[model samples]
Target: MNTLFIFLLLSTISSTLGQESPDPVRDIDGNLLQSGTEYYILPVVRGMGGGLTLGPRSDDLCPLDVVQENLEVDNGLPLTFTPVDPKKGIIQESTDLNIIFQAQSICVQSNVWGLVEYEGHRIVSASGTPGNPGSETINNWFNIRKFDDHYKLVYCPTVCSICRPVCGDIGVKIDENGTRRLAISDVPFKIMFKKV
Candidate 1:
C-alpha cells in the first residue's frame, strides 16, 4: 500500500510540474532587434537657370524676342507672335512661377555598430515617385561628405528614366536660420527613400 501511494504521489508531482513550467524555446534574435528608427522627408529643389549661361536662343530674356525668332527659324517659317485675343492676354501675372518639387519620403535605416550607438550604417532601400504613375527605385551609392560646418549628400551614379541624371548636394545645418536644403543642379525631379 505504501508503494502504491508513493507511485501516485510521484505521478501527480510530475504532471503538476509539467503543467506549471513554460516553454524553453525562444525564436527571437538579440542582435537584429531594433528599438527606434528615424525618418526624413527631404525636399529636393532644382533651379532651372541660375548658373546657366543665357544665350540668344535660351529662355532667359525678358522680352523673349530672340527665343521667338529662333523658334521661327527652326519651324522654317516666320512665326508671328499674334495673340488670339488681345484683351484676354493683357492680364497681370500674380501666381507663383517657381515650381516646388518635393519628394514623398526618405527612409534611412540605422543599425547599431560594435559597442557604438546606431549611426545610420546602411541605406538599405530608396524609392521615389516623380508625381507619376510608375515609380522608380533609386539604387546607387550616393556620396555623403562633410563640408564647412555642414554635411553634403550627393546622389549620383544612377539615372532616372524620365528625368535627367538625378544628382544633388544636400547641406544639413543645425543652427538657427540654418536648415537642411537640397540644391539639385540640373535634374527636374525629386527623390524619396524609406527604411525596410
Candidate 2:
C-alpha cells in the first residue's frame, strides 16, 4: 500500500538524518580543547538524572567513583589530549584526543580497544580491553570522544568484567514498577566535565 511505502521512506530518511557524524571535539562547555588542559568527566542519563561520576581510587572491576553528580571538578576523573597521531596512543580512528588516566592498583589505563566514532555516540555493541601494562595502544571502543556541551558515553551491552575505564561500564536503570533494566545499548549516558 501507499502507506507502507511512505512509512519506509520516512524511516530511511530519519535514520540517515539522525545518524551521528564526527563533530568537532569540544570540552564540557562546547569549547575547543587546549592541548594538555585537564577536564573532569561525569556521567548523566538522558531526560532523567545525572551524577554517578567516576573518580580516582575506585574499584578495579567497575570504577564506580561517585554515585551522585557534584560541582566539584577536581573530585571527578580527569581526561586530557586529543587523538591526533597514531603513535601517540590515539583514542580512536579520528584525531580526537586520547584519554589520559592510569590506575596502578588494578592495571588499567585510558588505552581503549574498540571502534570509536569521531564523536562518541551510538556505540555499535563493542567491548573495551586494556592493552599491555605500560602501553596505551589498546584498540578499545572508548566512546569518550568530546562533543559540544558534554562528553558522551558509548552504549555497550557487554563491558569488561574485571577492569574498565571511567566511561566504560553501563549503569542500572529502574522503572517506576520496580523493573530493573540494564543500561546497555538501551540508554546511553552523556557526561560533563567541570571546567576550572
Candidate 3:
C-alpha cells in the first residue's frame, strides 16, 4: 500500500509539472516565422495598470529584429533612440514618456513633457491630464502618428502599454494571397501592427 501511494503522488506531481511547462513551438504564436529565433520573456506585475511586461513571467512575444527593420523601411531611417535597457530586458524607446491604460480608456503624459517625432514632425506626443482618469484632458495622450499606415510596435503584454522595440536586422514578406505572414523563429510572445 505504501509503494502504491508513493507512485500515485509522484505521478500527480509529474503531470502537474508537465501541464505547467511552456512549449516553445506548439504553444508559441509567431514561432514559425522565418526571420530568426531569439526570444525574451517578461513578467506580469500586479497593480501596474494595463500593458504586459516581457521578462521572465509575462506571456508576451516580440520579433526584435524584424520589428526594427520594418519601422526603418517605412520611415526611411534607422531608429534614433536606443532601448532603455537591453541586458536587463527593459526595452523602451523613451523613458520620459508615460502611458496609462485605464478600464476601457488610455492616457498619455503631456505635450509639455515633449514629444517623439518622426520626419521632423511631432508623431508621438502626450496630451492628457495627470490624475484624472475620465477627463478629455486625459483622453488624447495615447496618440500614434500615421496610426493606420506607419507604426513602431513590439511584443507587449496584452494590456497595451508596455512595449519593447525590436532592433537588429530583419525582413517581412507579404504573401501573394494578400495575407500578412511572419517567419518561424523562437519568440516568447507575439506582437503585431495593424492599421487602426
Question: What's the alpha carbon RMSD for model 3?
Answer: 18.0
Better of 1 and 3 by TM-score: 1
TM-score for all models, in order of appearance: 0.19, 0.39, 0.18
Candidate 3 overall Cα lDDT vs. reference? 0.24
lDDT of each: 0.24, 0.40, 0.24
- Give the alpha carbon lDDT tens digit for every residue of 1-196 in model 3: 9999999999999998886422112102432211112232111222212212111101222211111122212311111111212132222221211232111212222321112222332222223233222222222222111112222222221212443332211112233442222222232122222111
Overlapping backbone residue pairs in candidate 3 total 16
Q: What TM-score does prediction 1 earn? A: 0.19
Looking at model 1, which ten-residue stretch has the lowest summed lDDT? 109-118
Model 2 TM-score relative to the real fold: 0.39
Where does candidate 2 stray beyond 4 Å?
1-21, 34-36, 44-75, 81-98, 102-139, 144-151, 155-185
Model 2, 166-195: lDDT tens digits are 344333344344322224334445566544
**Ranking, lDDT, top scorer first:** 2, 3, 1
lDDT per residue for candidate 1 within 1-196, as digits (tens), equals 9999999999999998886422111111212111122222222233311111111112322211111111211211111111112223221111101111122212221111001011221211112111221113232223333333322335442233463543454222122222121233332223221222
Model with the higher lDDT, candidate 1 or 2: 2
Tally clashes: model 1.
4
Q: Of the candidates shown, which would achieve the greatest lDDT relative to the real structure? A: 2
